[model samples]
Target chain A: MKQSALLDHPFGARYAAALPAADAARQDARETLALEGLPGPKREEWRFTPLRGLAKIPFIPAASADDIDVCDLPADVPRFTDAHRIVLVNGVYRADLSDTASETGLTVTEAKTPDHGVDAPLAVLNAAYMSGGVTISVRGVVAKPVHLVSIGAAGAEPAAFHPRLAIAVAPAAKLTILETHHGLPGQPYFSNPVTTISVGTAGVLRRYVLVREDSEAFHLATTVADVAADAKFDAFHLGLGGALVRQEISVDFVGEGAAVRLNGAYALMGRAHHDFTTFMNHDMPNCTSSQVFKGVVDGESRGVYQGRVLVARHAQKTDGQQLHKALFLSRGPQIDCKPELEIYADDVKCAHGATTGELDPDHLFYLAARGIDPQAARLLLVQGFLADALENVDDAVVRDILSGEISGWLMRKASA
Target chain B: MALLEIKNLHVSVGGKKILNGISLALNAGEVHAIMGPNGTGKSTLSNVIAGRDGYDVTEGQVLLDGQDILAMEADERARAGVFLAFQYPVEIPGVTTSAFLKTAINAKRRAEGKPEIDAMEFLKLVKAKQKLLSMPDDMIKRALNVGFSGGEKKRAEVLQMTLLEPRVAILDETDSGLDIDALKIVSEGVNTLRGPDRTFLIITHYQRLLNYIVPDHVHVLVGGRVVASGGKELAEQLEAEGYARYLSAA
Candidate 1:
């Protein structure tokens, strides 16, 4: 409800001079950001979660922040020994710490600075301060997954950075992309990343993202995927930790018979807040899209899930379904779930559902009666509650690691 | 010494009296059957003994190994060697049956200061006991009782009983959903666990189960009170003659 200046974070001519993309068209992005500030409480999309905390912080551009040491990956990162990894720190590529040379069907290069083309408020901000990212092109079937690790660390002052990723999969190609976003402890760092993906006809793209930022960090990520005819885009988004984090995904069914499965799960505690907003545009006929998101909130935390599916009039036979369920660990936490379906096609089958409830006492009692104590019983149930969504991750190794991470979060909550 | 003793137990559910001044004692290794017509607090007594919630003991005490179990949580009582085979075994999805059984076994071990069961040994034991119950080899791989048939649910309950090896086991209408074949396999499973260190309280509405795992003593409860107490013969008598006489007598 507080009205503040749109340029509260201070991005002026001096700020643009320090950016990595010197040749990028900066005037349009700056003007766009100047026109549209951070989303406020009045906007329905930002109603439940307030960005007042972000507006209050004096976040300098990450390009201007001291060169954070990029010697090692975060200790919490799951080292997938089988996958080829690409490392980035403070939005800039870190070739010194990368293992991408052995990868096949992957060519990593610098991405063009993003354009502010009638995008959302956060996307505009990402454009205005875009720093550095890579473009990955895939052809044929990739034997190993391509892992993208983005690390953020602030020095001396609070900092913010926007990393842009562009991906293209050739026709009949198959690839898996694993992304992890982590930051060092201390400092309220802000990370905004925009990812654009294009899956050619009959191509297959499997994406798995694990976001674990600092307890005081802010992460606003937007991902746009364009699926061609008969292409399959399967993705799982896992939100583990952050002070203010929102992972928004938009899928455009650009070709007929395309299929998309977007599933995610979040486990949050303390004052941490997370939101998963998805928009699936069914522009072509006979396409299918499904979204399943589950979360657990504790310690006065807040969780949100907003899903919208739009089916055009000509997009007949569009099968779209979405469900969001949140489990509250304590009375102090809050959950806001909104599921919207706008279907213009009469032959489409679209269903959206949202459920927010505390742990089922019956389930808890059943576990307890089997000799598991209340705490462990609750933990087991929470794991089970999020299992269906976690099952979306097709890779066995990644699935196990994510499940382990969730268990660790639950243990921390128990001890806290 | 009695392994379990229910002394003048008066239980109420949701402020309504279900059990009125019930008294019973079972020494270790004894199998006692509590039977009656429907709505006679047969299941209520079993639930109260297992430390289930929603049932308030308005009076009296239920003790296990001389320790007052009514004051303990359901899980505490379970770790202290109390088991309840729910009439309707809950279908817990995502937590596999093997995982639940392992946790239960580990819980008992932890309470007794014993090392946790080795995973291989645990699997071998489950396989052997599951064979006794005629359960499928992959039954343990499925989520705990989820999507299982009526008979499979009852069999899974008996499987948990076989694994936990509690000191005092309460089978609350375990025969309710089972067919005659499942009943035989489940009863055979229970009969194998009969030993000097363990005891059983089988609560049922029918005496058909008593034919398989014969009880040492049978008590006929009516109107929340034990109206008749006899040996296994009482079960047969009750089966032959309906509880009409006892219902009116109470």
Candidate 2:
């Protein structure tokens, strides 16, 4: 193994001593993290989103902070009807707070040590010091959806935790999962979570993620999915709160005739910063992928979206599309959007679009003419703008929940 | 006193005069029509009364029920019982017509210190009104005015006027793009709302609409001023002569 030059980095010797002794896999990942420190503004992929704020904080491991204890889920977390609830506090699964009933053809277990390497800086950090996670295996069509709620809190000092999650769906099986990431308001806490998903041939998986961490928290999540022949992967991500948050998702088609739909929406205010980075790799023939992301920025907040779609030489009959749109509520906010398509195959269909604009005065005046107040009119227009993206969510129940969350955010903004 | 009185209304758009010394009084239980050529400030008159921005009111006072409405914002004026039926209703995507209607109704109700309309009650009310306007039941399910035909948009305006029951309703070219059947239906909807407490100010460049909903009074607007005022015959005379005499006189 090559020696790491970044010994003084945050994820280096400073916090590495607090974690348990690492095995070979963790050691290899630690070496990788040391070699390539946290992404900075110099990096092309992370130019818009600088991690210097996160790097400046002196964060100790959450496991070493014994003073923090969360015995109950936050009241703000929605109670999904007829869904299995799994709770995670500071990255460790809490059985006492979970109400997961064992269903047929589905099994859940504690995730093992990291054995696979994901080529991302954050994933490398997560592999180095992952505290705890869950491995969910689906063997047949599951009747009820699974809800995984991750909560973060720091007591007496800024803390950080890395969690690893793995999901596998057998051939011809189907499942749906909803993940909600939340945190309490206190000393800043950082959550670094890595999720690996695999869908067998002809299987289906629907994943919905909602990240609404506390305003003083930082969350960086990495999700990589491998899809096989004729499988379908549908996912929607909704970001509402966090001081600084980045959700990076990448999908690779390993077999022919697979399809993927990755869509997301975000609302930011105050000094919050949110970034969404997506990569779609079509290495097989007859594969399709589409992405649609929208955001609303207010106050002095910032929003960024970077999408990269790649079609290999042999990947004929590939179809890929991406679009990003943002609305600004005030002059103090900033938005950055970049879409890159690298297509090497001639027989492929690819397109991308990005737009940034303020609310239309005509629409506002029209609503105002109907006796709707100015604030109420703006809320309606913003919701209408986001509705275009939210409509992509296939499930009506989940769509309603996400819409309610957006309304709540808007109400808070109005009051603030 | 007239229900809606406009006194010496002088309006300008972008520092250029549009309506110069325009005066009219619409009495209670009366329907008044203002007919003029295309550039005669008919739409400006309606827009100024509706409190749209960007129109500098150099010297004017629009009184609704004896309260000056020019000092109010567009939405405040709307809640104060002023409605303007747009010629081109805005197409707002993702906002269902049902939601917008409920919100508008609730805003008016709240202003009047009344409880908001419940879902069932609102549904019943809107369904009845929609039927009267000959609108399909699923029209409310779509986005507000999005993908709606011209006739549908006009009918929707009538539906809103009926639901709000404003004291003074100004229709800006309501007959512009309507077919004969749509015109009859829209006129019928407006005629049903005519009563002792309601007043109508119908602004149009054509007299064909007056044939269906005959006005109690007609005024000929030429060169930003009302050069002539008479009872229903003026609309017919202007239509027959095509405003040529009045345009030359102004």
Candidate 3:
């Protein structure tokens, strides 16, 4: 591994020079990134989603771009009633636009450079150039949800930003967080976000993420969560817009009787590409994990879902289930699905299924016979297909918000 | 002129002839029952009239209110007042029954230059219609026909027919999966919708359904063409003797 790998890429010396003085952790991450560069097609995890197109772009540090400014929340951003607002522009927190009011049992502070031993390429990239983010801690039942909105903008030239977020729930505590990633349209910008979460024993955490970046922008996010005994972690990720986007989530069950429900849905059109990669590590006995992912692709777009569940030899009574279903609106779109289940325990129950199909003609004809036009019929069917995954989101408000985003995407595709 | 007319219609599936020059005409305020044995193109007639794909008209004219409707697409024909009560209605998951009903009603209304149905008004209308069919109030909140029983699916079809109020309504094998009670309930639903402006084309293999709805005319179809036509008594005669005579004649 030579330093030329990083030098040849956009995030070499120039990106490092613009960043703040680094600590030992950041320096170690930068040296690792310089050694490995970005994951390429040879890496099995990155095979489906190649970063060649992303690496070719000469992107400057988003912090160095002084022309970009976001003074207010975007008009299209849905206002979640009673939820605390947290706004981030170009990866940096905006105090003026955010709601800094503190609530009981909940704390929010500027995220520090913590040594999270994550070796993934993108996670390393996030650590190497991490600019701004927040750390939210829950000590007791937090009644109100926290809404974190990340906004990205590039002026004159392509800009890149990396944000780090950490969340910790104390024993027997509960919390819910919603993340919405959006950006302005101009020169293509790149957003790299890494989130680390920990749920204490007997605790509960519900995290919902929605990504609708500009069509010309690039977004790659990674989330790692650890669940303790008798804890529950429910999460849903939705991807609707972006030229290229990938959401990777990894969950590690560290105690018995823990439960995790990870579900996601994506709707893509044009040349947009979206990918979801998940890893479930069942290291403790009596832990259960389930993943239901569904997506709809149109135009020349591409959708990918790669999920791996590993059960340790001692982790008996592990229950893991994963299913991926994709619908293609036309002949041009492509779907790649890979589901891997490794059960070293003899008493584990693990099942995985993947399916790709077009809209059922009978369904279309049924709607058509009822006077619904072909376009509207298609839209209804697509929404119905993705609704299976959306139903997994237990929170009604969050479900409706994601549904609205998917509906918006469908309407845009219908007109296009 | 007849409210719905089928004149010298010929249809084929996979280049194989199914309906061989079959024709029928239903005047305003009339229920015409087409009784035939299996493989006699009974379903084909209903599908062709409702504009289903994979069927080659080859040669035919299906007219609604004196206009040839074979040129219109399925949805266009539906908006132009054509409805088909499918024997096996498709099960569409995740599409709530209420949402589907509203979309259909709105489509018809939009085509007629009327405003869309408001949420409250739509719910009220569906509730009223559901009561007429003895449907549970929460049925509309479930996915469209996804988990419905056979009887419930048939009743839902009648509910749609009642809502859309099409000029020409075709019921294909609507009695196949219904029990006696469901049949009576479904027939009553059809009876309530029969009026001077509407005509019904009931396509069934058995004459049991006619006992409730009481068609004005009954035609015996065999081997893709009508072998005989007569008054309502024709249905009773077939019910007693079966379609052995018609099959031999064809």
Candidate 4:
């Protein structure tokens, strides 16, 4: 595809033409794509991020199908025991590869129309050509976790994959979902995915996303949540991989008495980069939202966090808090954090803070004096820095897995 | 044999002379009290002996059992069985007291080619030491010196010294922020650790602590050097007459 053809509009013709016909939400997707042009380093959000490499890639529709071998998952791998397992292979849903349906409270089908409103080009791209997006509906309270694994298969040729997912929590329902991403080695691909979540009245939904992809991969994902009255949404994100990764989370309190807690930890090393941008909109009264993001960057890595809490005029009694802290290990690494609170309501308590610093030298000295090697001292301090975020995870099993992954990543990076 | 010997030590901080040509020798099983007024570099002497950074040792040599200790780093000095009970203990948050002490003890052990103690064994050691000091069990689990009272912090210093079992223990004003009861408890803990193979150097301004932990030798430090060295009677004389006459003569 010619560069001009891709630049003619926000949603390139190649992207629109490559979208499958089965995706019925293409119109809303296209409108969302009209929001912005291709991002460059000049853009404020893309300042520290190097977009030149992305701009150089030719725009082409991902090939229809390719042969991809599936690796055997570990025996102790986390799986949603009660809910149905949905597997998306190379941005296309493969029903034959997933487990059979088992429960009545959970149902997975293709989205007929996008219910959650999103006005971003990335969202449009995900909605437009989304190959096998999953639409999950939980009717009532459910006692199991839903495991959604996105597996990116290495094709004979390089391509881009966009996956879309929608989750709806019915009234008085409770559900926990673990969404994970797995990519094949030597597969140089871009994953632009979007997930929409709706929490009904008196419902509770806990979502966790664990992203560990090939080091050369590009991941751009956005999660949009719409909460109802007296609903609770607990979301945790763990970012440990990817050459360049950006996850944007936007939440809207459309009903009164809704509460949301957003906690995340990102541990990056080498030349890897990660960005977390969040926006919480309060449109009703008596709502609360809290967000905390902690990151550890070593080597030449970089981390970025931008969070904003918006309180509408009529949304009185809104309580919101946002905190972002990062530890930069090496002098070459950097962290950029911007936390904003925009409140139009008169009676509201909103606070935000951002801090970036190196590891405590005294603490390191003390640890080293205790006979721990310098590298082990660093690992302990990093673990301490990320302890608060990990504490927010309710499941012990999941917390252990996450902690092991972080420690393993650190060890690997140190060894390299 | 001398356990710790400081030969003509001259030290300065921020270009100001603190310890000028001060010399002291501490033999095993000896408890030597070095009494001086404020600004006389008593704390500086202890810090210099402990190898704390930011202090310039212009001309001096600290020998721990005849080894050049002034060239060692603070941790190296610590591993070499030199412990300094600070006048003001630093508060380290997020690190438990028991954890810190265990790490220190293990470090010392590793330096001596000894195997590390198991968790249960270490816990037993902590229990014994806590009981000896009459400290609450919760103090061990709390963050190191964080939110600890003055006396509690002093007791913690003593507890750490007992656990580490250093060859030369330098108590830098351990009695400064302690009550009569706490002082007695701390002195008892120190007294229990006293042996022919260990040396104690207690830095203080008052002789009250000496009443509990009797010093075998007393040194009156004036103008950063020992101006008067005598038996334990020196402490009583200074307690009764004060250092006013000595300061004027020096």
Candidate 5:
């Protein structure tokens, strides 16, 4: 995957000088990408889902694609009428299509450079070309959720966009954020985004993310969240589409008594490849973190779940658990699951499990005995299998939306 | 014509003969109870009739209104008005009981050229059936049979039977894991479904459930064959003497 096939976007010479806040960090990230290009298959982390297809693409820095005009939010955006909306196209915030009514206890400002420890290649790539991101700071409990919709589109030529977002919740604050990553149906587009979240003392942050890129799109997103003492952070990531999509998340518990629940589900068909790589760093004692991820693959697609829970030497009484289960809808598909637990503390408790299999014949027979035809029975069972992991989603509306998306996928699969 | 007929039905599971030449004729409006001892192929008869997989009908004929039901798929037989309330209903996680009920009911309804049941109509029908089975309203809201007590599973089975109202209902050990109250409630639900157009084959080891639903005819099954057949008094006779007489005859 790392063969100098795809040329680098000039962040130092072309874009970094104009971008505010993280100019130096952007240069550093570009250097990191230059030093460590997209990790090859030899790297154990990238062994499951290689970036050969990504490397073959002639992706120009999305910033250079000035002709890529995003006039409106894509039609596939899940409509939640209650939540306030914030729209971003090609990494730039579009105020005209956004709704910020009665958004008290919330302040949305210009993009600020993200300083989340030194370099992951994609994180640095996001910083190098980062533009059109928002800094959302919350002081008090927000009544309604703030919906962030990031749209990606390329014109005649293949393009890419790097969107940055920094979210901070003050002490004793409560907030819910729903992000829908969508793309227009045209030329192939690459969306590389970095999102950083900071939760304060005793604060609660519930975030749900949906990545539904177009079939011809590439999306590599990195999300970093720091949870303070007595704080609770719950996130559910849903990866539905994209040519080459990777959602890498790092959740660090900075203070004792913090809790983090990261759960996600993905359904892929055709030749799509999706990778969900998560790192739960327990730097403080008495922190509990759990992750449950499930996926369904069909039509020669591949899926990978790489979950690593790192418990530091001083982080005693830390409880970390992760489980990944995948269902194969067809014989052509492949799934790779790696659950790594690096526990350096003796008093720490950790567990990990991974299972990959097809639908149970007994379950199918039970459904068939109830008069559900095999096709319909399969749809119901597949929906149910993913629904088990979707139970982690607490929000009713988002859960319904995710369910509808799955149904949509199923119907499409059936028709295909 | 009999509503259902099993003619010389011989079934084998994995090369071993389970049901050997068990023939029975169930007329419309008749409630026939099959009382048998352990290892007597009680469930094999029901599964073979209902068209379950794995059990090979080496030589047999399971007829629904004189049409060969063994030739049809399990779901096809179901759409043909054959229902088997499983002895041990499966626990299917994530598929809600309400949804399962609606799908099964609608599948039959669709076969009859009826539209899919609307939400309100479905809710009303389910609510009424739940009330009939004395099942709690929220019972259907949970996953099908998952985390349910033994009584709840059997009651759910009866609830499904009441909803589907098949022309031929086979209650296969429906009273196996029931306590006194669940047995009464489940028997009452089955009793309510009994009618002139419907025929029932109640499979049970004990004669207790026959007291609740009062079969018109009782057949003694032992060693994979119907050793004897008679009126309701035969069930009483078996209860008194146990199946030792029938067990020896085979």
Candidate 6:
């Protein structure tokens, strides 16, 4: 049978016909069409993550606008009043639920086609039938941060949702954006999201993402950020709770004097799985970037971190450092980390390192010898290991919120 | 009654005897110094008393304050008020000294069914002890002994010892890397904690530390055994004459 016919069987024929025109990208997608169920052990990245439920769940596009209810923001959730807020419910942007205005130098529109070299099948699928996605642009410098909130609500039936967002920061402009993923109670769904961000010359942008999904939920997201000359981008990611999640971030430094700092922390327990994959490309000179990611895995959980820094020949003086470390709290738990640096320029300073091990026995002994219980000692050591990455977050309120969330998660895991 | 009593202790590491038939008794309000050469099993005796793992107590009974401590784990023994000032304190990165000390103190307190100490109370206690040890406030704020000078590390160990307030403290060559000033400061800290309820075992290679903290009893450890025991005068004799005679005899 032809590849298109296989994709047509589960997801309608029309969806399969909308595959990307890029032959190589489509071929790669087609070859994996037989993966009707979750990407299993056969897939390299999904080897540690369980996804059988995601593969077996029938694929259904988001329901009509009236079928989804948009509730008021929970009191516990922080709000940015001055900034424009765009809310997406179950992969569909709800205009009635959002407070965005096109006249405010920001526009929210549905993308007709995957524009600007987005040839991946997932991107094409998001483009072909995506319901609600906003195109946010700051014509000039904007004083306020733009908040984009995407939420996945559980429906009565097994469902899947794909949310797409395209962002463009104009020259010399600054933007701070916050994105959160929340699963409604009884909402068992699969969320596959793709966001593309472009920073113009001398622009600055800070993006904070918090992912707290239900344990039964499956989340797959990819973020592509491109930086122009003299631009700076900082991103902080916190993965607190997820059944199985893989977040991939790719940043391309296309112009000289551009800089980026990527920091993330993942605290997971139970049978949950969380993976973070980052790829940084330095194509211009005098560009700098650093990434510090730490994870704490307990119970039967698993964590994976794969980071790569690529420096081209012309990308000289590209100071890049990547460090990934993980602490395994239980013998049944495991963490796999791979940090790689491929440098082609002699003048560039690039280094990468990865370490995965259990908590230090000596530190534990030291704590215990001081009269602390074994459980509390483990918690303290885990917190110390994650402190460096947590301190990297510049916003105090956000940092406090993230820390509290992580502590709560850990406490619950310890009790459970 | 003695606060700590070791009877016929025989400890071996990796199938080699390090402490053979060693015995000692420590009474409250008393300091006993054990002076010996480098390979005289001074450290092994301290470690064995602290219940360090992998040290096979082939034949021995370690009693702390009338309780058999050899059967307890390291932490249990610590809670029972036995502390070992490590010769080389382990450096823990990313953990502040103050936070570590507070956690340790509270851990012990909590294990004893006591309420946790408040933040202000902890700060007050730390400040008072810092003044006693003449340690800078920054030393407590920095990562646990990370990037600290050798003398600073030794001072930090003394600081912990003062805060934990163990009933029987064993200083295992803590003066090895200290200068005269640091040695005096550390000894002063130990002296301040000295009381009728507390005892100490100072283990060192030279009698230099003995000058600062005079011991009531001095024992010459040779060939994994206490070859000679005498009053404080024994330390002076060993200091005037070196370990040359003892080394040759062993």
Report the candidate with higher TM-score, 2 versus 5.
5
TM-score per prediction, in order, is 0.96, 0.95, 0.97, 0.85, 0.96, 0.87
Candidate 1 scores an iRMS of 1.2
Q: Is candidate 3 or candidate 5 better by TM-score?
A: 3
Candidate 3 regions off by >4 Å? A1-7
Clashing residue pair totals per candidate (backbone < 3 A): 0, 0, 0, 1, 3, 4
Task: Give the winner by TM-score.
Answer: 3
lDDT of 4: 0.80
Q: For each candidate in the order shown, give its overall lDDT on alpha carbons.
A: 0.86, 0.91, 0.91, 0.80, 0.86, 0.78
lDDT value for model 3: 0.91
Encode model 4's per-residue lDDT on B4-119: one tens digit a residue: 99999998899998888988889999999999898898988987887666799999788988888888777777777888887877666545677677767777788889998899
Candidate 3 structure quality by residue, lDDT tens digits, A86-190: 898988888898985788999988876745767678999989888888888999999999999999899999999888888999999999899999999899999
Clashing pairs in 1: none
How far in Å is the alpha carbon of B66 misplaced in model 2?
3.0
lDDT digits (tens) for residues B46-150 of candidate 6: 988887767898997888877889988888888889888888887887677887888888877877799988999998989989988888877888878888888
Query: By the lDDT metric, which is better: model 3 or model 6?
Result: 3
Q: Output per-candidate TM-scores for chain A, rounded to 2 decimals.
A: 0.95, 0.97, 0.97, 0.89, 0.93, 0.84
Tens digit per residue, CA lDDT, model 4, A1-416: 22332323223665566545534466656654544455555555556666556555644445453455554443334454554567776666667767745677888886445555566546766765565577889988776677787876556655677777888999899988888786777656778788889999999999988888778878889889999999999999999888889888999898999999999999898888999989999999999999989988888888989898999999999999999988888888878888888889999999998888887766665554444445656766676667547778887656666777776677777787
Stretches of candidate 4 off by over 4 Å are A1-24, A27-37, A58-65, A74-115, A133-141, A144-153, A368-375, B35-38, B86-106, B115-160, B173-189, B204-214, B218-223, B227-250
Q: What DockQ do the predictions score, one after another?
A: 0.69, 0.77, 0.83, 0.25, 0.69, 0.44
Of candidates 3 and 1, the better by DockQ: 3
Superposition error at B236 for model 3 (Å): 2.0
For candidate 3, what is the DockQ? 0.83
Superior candidate under lDDT, 3 versus 4: 3
